[model samples]
Target chain A: MTPAAPALPPALDILGIAVFALTGALTAVRMRQTFVTAAFFALITGVGGGSLRDLLIGAPVFWVRDALVAPVCLATALLAWFTPVRWWQGQLLEWADALGLAVYSVFGTMKALSWGVPPAAAVLMGVVTACIGGVIRDVLAGQPSILMRPELYVTAAALAAGLAGAGVVLALPPALTWAIAVAAGFGLRGAAIHWSLHLPAHGGEE
Target chain B: MTPAAPALPPALDILGIAVFALTGALTAVRMRQTFVTAAFFALITGVGGGSLRDLLIGAPVFWVRDALVAPVCLATALLAWFTPVRWWQGQLLEWADALGLAVYSVFGTMKALSWGVPPAAAVLMGVVTACIGGVIRDVLAGQPSILMRPELYVTAAALAAGLAGAGVVLALPPALTWAIAVAAGFGLRGAAIHWSLHLPAHGGEE
Candidate 1:
C-alpha cells in the first residue's frame, strides 16, 4: 500500500536519535569506558533499532545513508563525555527516553506499514524501533536487559505501535492518532518508571 | 557486479543455519529455558547475521520470505533439547561452527558486493553475517558476547571476507575464489580452536 500518512519530520527524527544517543553515551561513560567506546555506544544505541527495522523490512539502513546521523551520534557522545555522569541523574533522562520511545514507536510502525509488512508485524516493528537500541546497549555493557526485568517498556511501545497501526488500518486521521499514541505510550512508561512498576514474573523460572 | 558467482548451494546454507541454530538452542537449554525459548534462540542465531547483512545492503531479508529456514531452526532446537547437553560438549559443534562461519562470511561479502557496497564494507558485511547472530544469541541469553573474548572468530571471518572481496575485485573466477575463501576462513578458525589461539587483547583492558 502507498504511504497515506505524511513522513515523520526529519527534525523530529533527529531529535529522537539524539536523545537515545545521549543515553547510550551515558551508559558507556558510567561503565568507565574510553571515548571511542562511548562513541560506539552512542552510535549503536541511536541507530540500532532503526537499522534493524530497515534490515528486516528490506529497506536501506537509515543512518548509513544519511549524512547527518553519524555526526549527531558522535557529537552527542562528545557532549556526554564532557559532562559529568552525576549531572545526568534524575527524571530528565527518563523523560527524554520516554519521549524518544513514543516518537520512535509510531515512526517505526508507519515505516513498517509503508514497507508492506502485515499489521501485526508493523506493531512489533514499533516496539523494536523504540526498544531494541537499548537492548543492544545493555547487552554491550554486559548488563541485564531491561526486557528481562519486565518493566512496562515493551508494553508501552506496543501500545503506541498498536494504536498507530490500528489507526492507519481503520482510515483514521494520522495527526490525531499519532498524538494519542505518543501520549499513551509516554504516560505508561512515565508511570512505570516513576512508580517502579514491574510486570509479574514467571514463577519457577526467573 | 553481475553476481558472477553462482548462488551458494541451498543445502549448504540450510546446514549452516542448522548448526548455528543448534548452538543457539543449546544455550537456551543450558539456561534451563523452555522449548519456546530454545526455539527463539535457534531462530535468532540462525538468521540474525544474514538479516543484518541484508538490512545493511538494502536487500529483502532472506529468511522472512524463505519457507524452509524457520522450520529448520525449529527442528534443530527440538533436536538440541532432547539430546544430552554433554553430548554437544565435543569438537563436533566447533567444527560445524567453523564451517558455518566460513560459508556465511563469504556469502555475506558476496551479497554486499553485489549490492554495490565498497570492498571494505563488504568485508565487514562478511564478519557481520558470520558473527552477529552469535552476538545476538549471547545477548539474548545475557551472557558476555564472544566479541569480549580474545578469540580469532572475527579475524577468521575478516580473512575470508577480505580475500573474497579482493579476489572478485581482481577478477578471479568465482567458484575457485569461494572455495579458497571458505577454506581459509575455516582453516584459521580451526587452527584457533584446535590450538587455543587468541588475538591479543589490550593489556590494561582484559
Candidate 2:
C-alpha cells in the first residue's frame, strides 16, 4: 500500500520540525535550564515523533540518516537561548505549534501507510508522530502531561490523520487531501486555543 | 556483527516483561484508574523499553511480533486490579523493579550490540530500554518523573549496560557475562534502596 506521494514537501517538513524545536527550546528556557539542556530538549522535541514512527514502522530513524535535521534543531536552540523570553510571549508559539501538529500528523500518517501499516494504525501513527515529541518534552520538564488532559489537542490530530487515511483509501489527489487535512486540524486547534475549548470531562467535573 | 547468542532465554525474557508489567499495573491501580487504563498501562510499560530499543536498532518490535506478550501483560493487570493494594505495599515490588531494570538493561545492550550499534550508543540504548517505560508511566501518572530526580536508578542501569557492552567487546562468555552484569546492576539498585542512596546535586543542594 504505497502512499501516492510524500505527505509534506521538504521545506514544509523542515519548517514543522523547526517549529516544534522552537517550542521545546522555549520550554527549557522557561525553566531557566542551561544551553546544553535547551539544545537537548530541542533535538528530542524536533525528532521525537518522526523517529518513533519510523522505528515502529521498521524504517531507519529519519534524523539519524539526515545530517541536516540535528543541526537545524541545534540552531533553533541557539536562537532560543540568545533571545530573551519576553520576545516569545503570546499565542504565536501556540499557533505555530498547531501548524506543526497538523502538518506532522499528515506526514506521519502518510509515511505509515506507505510502510504498509494498516489504515487504523497508520492514523494512530500519525497522532504519535505529531504529539509524542511534545509529550516527551512535557514529561522531561516535569510538566503536567498533555495526555492526562481532556483537551481537543489529540482530537484535532486524530481528525487530520483520520482524514488523511481516508483520502488515501479513496485514492484522492495527495495535494488536495493534505491541504484539507491540515486545514481542518489547524482550524480545530486554532479554535480551541482562541476560545479555550476543551472536551467535556468524563463526569462533568468542570 | 551478529551476537553470539540471544540476549536472554525465552523464560527469563518473559519474566522480566511480566515484572515490569506488574509495576505499571500497580501504578494505575494506585491512581484509582479503570481496569482498561490499568491494562493499557501494563502493556505499554511491559513493552516500552524493548520496543524503543528495537526501534532504535531497526529490529521488529518484540511484543508486537510475539503472540504471548500482550496476554501476559493483561493478565498482570488483572492480577493487580483484583487484588487489594495492601497486598503489594512494600519493598518487594521495588526489589522486583530492580531485578527487571538489571536484566532489561543487559538484554537491551546485548541486542544493540547484535545490531551493530556502536559500543557507547549500545550502552545508552540499554539505559533507554530499562528506564523509559517507567518514565513514561510516571509521566502519565502525573508523578514527578524519575528523570528529574538524582536517584541512583538510572545510574544502576547504566552500570549494567556498560558492563554488558564491555563484556561483549571483550568477547567474554555470554552466560557468565550476563550473570555478572545483572548481579552488579541489581546490587547497586538494591543498595540504593536499602540505604537511601542518591547522587549529589549539581551544587550540593541536598
Candidate 3:
C-alpha cells in the first residue's frame, strides 16, 4: 500500500490528545484522586487507543516514540488539577471530545489501511482507536463504560471509521474524505450529546 | 541482548490460556449472556494481556498467529456454557487462576526481556501479561476490577515478575528461576486467597 491516506495534521492530532487527556484528568479529579493518579489517567487515556491500534497493526507504539504526547497529557492533567471543576463543565468539553473522537477514528482507519490491514479490520481498528481509551478510563475509574450503555458513543465512532474505510475503497481525494468523515462523526456525536440520543436497549428475549 | 530465558513449555502455556479463558466465560455466564458473548469474553480475556505486552514490546500478537489459542478459548467457553454454574464455584477456579497468573507473569517477563525491554519495564510487562486479561474481563462485564481493591493480586504478579528479572541478572538456570518465580507468585496469591489478605486501604488525607 503506497500511502493511500495522508497523516493527520499535527495540530489536530495534538488537540485530540489534549482533549482526551482532559477528559481523563477530569475523571480522576471527580473521583478525588491524587495528582499522580490524575496524571496517569491523563497519559493512559490520551495514548490508549492509538497504542492499541499500532500494536495490532504491528507498528511501534505512537506515544512511546513521540516525545510531545506524554508531556501534553501531563500538562493537561496539571491544568485540570489547578482549575475549578465547574469551569470545565458543560458543552465545551463535550464538543471538544466530539471533535477528538471523529478525527482520531478517521486517523486510526487511515493508519491501519496504510499498514495493509484489511479494510474491514481497519474500520474496527478505527473504532478501537476512538473509543478504547474512554473504555479504559471508565474501567480504571470503576465506572460503567459508556459502551455498556445504549448511548450513541460507539455507534458514532463506527460511523466515522466505516466512512473512512469507504472513502479509501472509493479512491476519493484523501483530504476531502478525511474532512467529510470527521464532520460526519462529530455531527453525530454532537447531536447525540445535544438531543440525548441513544440506541434502543437490548430487548430481553430469546 | 540475547534471550536469557527459554519459552514456557507449550503444555503449560495452553493450560494457562484455558484457565484464563474459563474465568472470562464464567463472568459472562453468571451475567446470563448468550454463548456468543461468552465466547467473545473467553477469547478476549485469554488474549488481552499477552496482546498488550506484544504490542508494547513490538512483537507479533501471539493468539493471532497461533491456531490453537482461539480454538482453546472457544472450547473453554463452550464448556462454560453447557456446564452448571455451581460446578465451577468454590476454590478450584481461584487456584487455577493463581497458577495461571504466576506462570503467565514469569513468561511475560521472559518474553519482554528477550525482546529488549528494560528489566524494570519487563517486570511491569510480566504484571501486565498476568493481570490485564482479567482486568479486561471484569471491565467488559461491568464489575469492579480486582486491581482497584487493595488486594495482593498485582503484588503477587510483581513478585513473580521481579523474581524472574532477578534470576536473569543473577544468571541462574532458566528452569530453576522460572520454577521458583512461579512458586513464589502462586504461594503469595494462594495465601492471600486463603486468608482474605489485602493491603491496607489508602487513608483519606491531604
Stretches of model 1 off by over 4 angstroms after superposition:
A1-6, A204-206, B1-59, B63-135, B144-206
Ranking by DockQ: 1, 2, 3
Question: What lDDT does model 2 reach?
Answer: 0.84
| Candidate 2 chain A minimal-lDDT segment of 10 residues | A197-206
Best by lDDT: 3
Encode model 3's per-residue lDDT on A164-189: one tens digit a residue.
Answer: 99999999998888888999999999
Per-residue C-alpha lDDT of model 2 across residues B38-106, encoded as one tens digit per residue:
765787789888888887787777664355776788799888887777778888889989999999899
Greater-DockQ candidate between 1 and 2:
1
Q: Once superposed on the true structure, which residue ranges of model 2 sit more than 4 Å away at CA?
A: A1-7, A202-206, B1-43, B56-58, B62-135, B142-206
Q: Please provide, for model 1 over B129-165, each residue's C-alpha lDDT reduced to its tens digit, 9 standing for 90 to 100.
A: 9999999888788788888889898899999999999
Judged by DockQ cut-offs, is candidate 1 incorrect, acceptable, medium or high? Answer: incorrect
Per-model TM-score, in order, reads: 0.61, 0.61, 0.62
Candidates in descending lDDT order: 3, 1, 2
Q: What TM-score is obtained for chain B in each of the predicted models? A: 0.95, 0.94, 0.95
Residue-by-residue lDDT tens digits, candidate 2, A147-204: 5555678778878998998999999998988999999999999998999887653221
Candidate 1 per-residue lDDT over residues A1-206, each given as its tens digit: 33453367899889889999999999999889999999999999999999878778766777897899999999999999998787899889889999899889999998888877777667767877888899889878988765544677877887898899899999899898899899999999999999987755322222
Residues B58-166 of candidate 3: C-alpha lDDT, one tens digit per residue: 7778889798999999999999999999999989999999989999999999998887776766776798899889888887887866555566887788899989999
